[model samples]
Target: MSKGRILIRNGHVIDTEPQPVAHAHTDVLIEGGKITAVGRNLRSKGAMVIDATDRIVLPGFVDTHRHVWHSALRSAAIDIDLGAYFRLLGQVGPKFRPQDVRIATLAGALECLDAGITTQLDFAHIAYSPELANAAVDALKEAGLRAVFAYGTPVNVTAGGKLADVRRIRERLADDNALVTMAYAPLGPLSTPMETVARDWRIADELDLPLTIHLASSPNNEQPIFALREAGLLREKTLYVHANGIGDDELKLIADSGATASATPGDEAGRLRRAGITTGTGIDTVAFAPGDMFSTMRAAHLAGQIAEDPQLTAKDVLRMATLDGAAAMGLADRTGSLRPGKQADVILLRLDDLNMLTAERDPIGAVVTEAQPHNVDTVLVAGKVVKAGGRLVHADLRRTARALRATAAAISGR
Candidate 1:
């Protein structure tokens, strides 16, 4: 794999370092690990040149919510809904050991990279031990993906034990600029005690790490927004996931605090708009929401349309999939978009492909509305070609898939 300097020439670039900057045809230079330049006809020696003639170059996707360690149970919970998910996870979650977590996290992270997602928040709600947490971090490091290993505290772990393990893991993976980093996946006030939640939130804040929690899903884990508000814990660094069915008051609370929301968006536009939230999109479960950020984007767009909100656009929806997502993961200053001095995490989408040939009139529209993972022809993480020519360059997917399959079989007694 070419892991050094790369110069991609002659691609239509969608550079959203913040606002969108579209270049009809330009050059982007990458040296070491950062984007050196983005312009027309740039020249640099010793850089491996990539001819992106028929490609659309954009910043790689940021997926804010994915239970990546559940890859071992891919088809295990697809048909189930919100209620069954909690019950099933309660039953099957304990079955996974450290080896299974490593395999699942590595394989799942590679799949996201292959799908043009350069950064992810792996909601690893399976960390039952310090060894398991370490294995999870090791898997992300080995996969060479930028990630937030959200430490999902096991039910059996005391609050003190949770903090201790998180401290150990964070110190071990102490590089704030490392490709793999740590985040707190607190159970929140709904599942965890209020005092414990406060303590955990304080720990995350003091560590300068991001915090992500399952948001106020109704009929079970409801009213979490108020609980968090009462404690004065809602802030910009916190990412509330699957923020469905939240009330207008809760929306005001979230929006006013400078916090952000992540939506899976099966049907969530009304609440999101009411909250006046700059909502980011995410793929939640391997059993359901795989590495399909495009689908989530489309769902968000449709939700806005369905709610009759006139402020939505396909391009802004695309922003949710990229820039806003980086904000949700608390990494906007690093890996979200194509800019000088930011990490070179980018993707080359094949606009010459069948589905895009006729629909390529509007690049952002085509990408948001029609393009799927199949159109992702190349992916780069930190200037390295992790996936090229529509395939992952650094992983043995078959071996990993086989191991997951075997693990699933044994767990099911099949």
Candidate 2:
């Protein structure tokens, strides 16, 4: 194995484990895509060293949910309700050519790296063709980010052809696991036929790959749960996204299936649009948000509180965003926490930041409530410096932003 040279020193390591608050200073040694050592007075020659004296080192955030294609549409449908937004996305989604997906995904992936998100579950639903899927995967790889490219089979494509095409694409792209993993992302029940969704799940199971689907995004999707139950397709391998409208029975089914759930509170709150609905109706669902883990933690904490369970701790919320999320995506063995032998995917949060300084005693509390994207000083994906001083090292932010603006304008026909 080849070793990469990099050293991070003089930082307060804030891993998931709870240690003494005052034990702050430490050195981290990174060699060949993994953390070789972490302690005081670590020595290494001919290695690049980063001064992290005032920063808080942590495991890089894992964003379990995001529509990367919607990066250009940030707040585009802010005034429109959910129904209208869906209609608009449905119309606009297919209009995007493969080039558009490449640009949008590249921009979104770069933004995530800049925001200190090391690993992301990019639910790419804009894959109207195999070329679009390949383009999105290529963009993620070029950005040097870890991602699971969930290849979405558009309803139109499935209706136009047979299931064999989906299988062929999965087979061709399943082995390329350098920085990107391929997963099956079937459009959820409301838009896609239940039979196709089940067929997709069967293929996913046969290939032993993680399967993701948008579920219970609205009240109308309740019937899909029953359909899944009838088909006996609800299983742990199935990762359900935005399952806000699920009930107790569905929760039991999920628990029995050993499946996992991801909830994006920020997007769910209609920050982008009214979206008609107020909150997802899922049961025992975990909270999630792309690009920002602090907000996701807070949202999970609040959701637990709303369920009359005020005893939920910040650590619990953090786990959902980190470890639980990795398990949900079936990548727990490789990443998730800061442990020996795990990939060195880590982030450094500035403790002195005003938002993070309030709770000095509880590091978890500081991370969940006080830390923001700006507090991120450094981010490492697979033991590489992707973000330093809160800026992307390999991304051209200004140009990407301009391109996204033009793409959005074109889509809106303005």
Candidate 3:
């Protein structure tokens, strides 16, 4: 609209950049997909103006780690623990055909957008074949979300792509500036041999792609971070997911290495933050946890209070969901905050909604503690209006629903 110029006017703007700040009755101007100005009474010729009155305009949420393809199996293992969840996925992962992966990934990405997650690092460990990997990436592009499609080994599958296939996928996703980029999601030191881990890290290093892997969420006592350090494979481009049950010493090592960590709400997120690690919020899986960042932030806050950690405040949790998460995924400079020259990945939440009606005094606290997905009134990615007036634009939800149901039924034999 208006030749790629949008001006959001008269909103309570919140920014989580160098630090968290709130500006009342502010305006934002976006031109050609980049934020040009954020202040009072901003003007742009031929700009399409959207009134953000009684709305919380802020940077969209970033999910540092998510198994997006598993959204097809949502709540399938909600009652199970990590070990049993893996066991169940062992059976379910192999049953996903290429088309099934496509539908699941598309639905998943749309779900993320609906919940105000403008960016996600998809830990797609379901690449059972080259075709499957392509299907997942294609679905991300189709859904139009900013994503990092981390190519990884499929679970419990023998005849599928291996570490070498990472190189193959890298060839296809070479453009780093695209909406959908690539990462390497290798089985880290805990699951693979030392030599295999070394090789995978080298491949990712050579490709200049970020590395993300699950670490320290299991009962095993192995020090995966330490192992990476001793092997000289630890790098800042690596994102360690679910660093639960890790000791303080290991957390210090993560901080010292300049590496980042992702913590799902139910995990040891508070501990990670208390240890001074740059922790970000992750939904982990829709199959087991809520997909919305509001719920994720609430859970993280409650967990911090339960642990008696004094460092966790509402602002802190909000930062974890926004700028910190972007930094964790190495995209902070491009899309995290409401700053000039950054991509316009932003959302507006209606403060008039019953769930958020009392957010006038402490908007950040209400956002973390009271807001829900239904309050999201508008969403934009790269200056494009993906959602407006509480509905997705150019989306065929009925069709997506039918395909999702058929795929889930086929996979479940129901």
Candidate 4:
């Protein structure tokens, strides 16, 4: 984690915390993989200088929930709905070997970095074996991205796959530091039996790892938030992903239990709408949802505005992508902000990009509104440059894409 001194000079910094936020023309000094200072004209001797002029420096985006393994299969689910996705993955997943997992993880991780997602909670369900699990972890390390490898318990929970296996993986990866962390990803309560879920939660509690589950809305099964509450299972480390249209009682219980929630609005909004257009359950959607976190932010903002409860400011909307997301992963102390003591996981987006030609004056507005991945000029993870000059470092984009296609072809027996 000891990335050497990096002096980012003369960039407008959107430091989202500790008052006096969003300074213009600020210099940031990073040392030993941590932010050392943020001020005007800061200098560090013998530091690697990065020209951040004409760029807006912000804490890199954090994605609270993502199935990163699918990076190898980009747009695979784009045309399909929730049911088709389940069917497709169910058929193709078993054919993937360890090498495939490694390639997919690395590709996915790079995609996140390229998109300016500095920290990601990668819900890795493909690692049914330890070798596969280690492969995913290794790829994350090699990608030099900050990630939480949310280890999923196996399909055959009756056999070798258990919390002990997770513990063993943790022991194997004991050397992993802040750059690559661990999490407990288990089948949600509605999917698995309550007894098994109870055991998994107990194991996660004993291990003191954050637990994330997809409490997705399904009419086929009765909502289980009340059941989880009755079972005394909710905790601060508990994160419910994409619990859209959840009842007020469930939301209140989740809040009272000190649990967190995350929304991958792209997947949810798209799935619902696509399902409506397709053969699956045509769930009603009030607003048209697109495929980015910005759309998610917009959805949340609109919801808050419509309710007249608490209208979100630009900062409030941005916090869901930054501090709140890190809090969901229990990583708020490290990588979420641009604090002096935090890890130097930062990104610079070019305000000079074509998308920004008609941009608003508010920095945070652009971040939560119009900024695209192509606008990412530079990205640093743990103070190391993983993306520079709007291109991913240490990557052969064309070759990687080709390899991914070959992988898909092999999987499909083409």
Off by over 4 Å in 4: 18-20, 153-160, 217-221, 266-311, 358-360
Ranking by lDDT: 3, 1, 4, 2
Best by TM-score: 3
Q: Quote the positional error of residue 402 for candidate 2 in Å.
A: 2.4
List TM-score per model, in order.
0.94, 0.85, 0.96, 0.87
How does each model score on lDDT? 0.80, 0.67, 0.87, 0.72
Q: Residue 130 of candidate 3: its Cα lDDT?
A: 84
Give Cα distance to truth, residue 117, candidate 3, Å. 0.5
Give each model's clash number. Answer: 0, 8, 0, 0
For model 4, residues 1-414, the per-residue Cα lDDT tens digits are: 236999999887888774225777899999988998999988667999888777889888787777777765566666667677767767767777888888877877787788788888778877767788888898888888888888875443442255667998777655436578888888867577677788888878777778888775465336678778778787777877766666666666676777776755433323222222100011011112332455566665555455434454557657767776776677778877899999898999898888876443677778777778789889988898888888987778787777767777787783
lDDT of 3: 0.87
lDDT of 1: 0.80
Cα displacement (Å) at residue 315, model 1: 0.7
Clashing pairs in 2: 4-32, 82-275, 244-280, 244-281, 244-282, 245-281, 245-282, 246-281
Report the number of the highest-lDDT candidate.
3
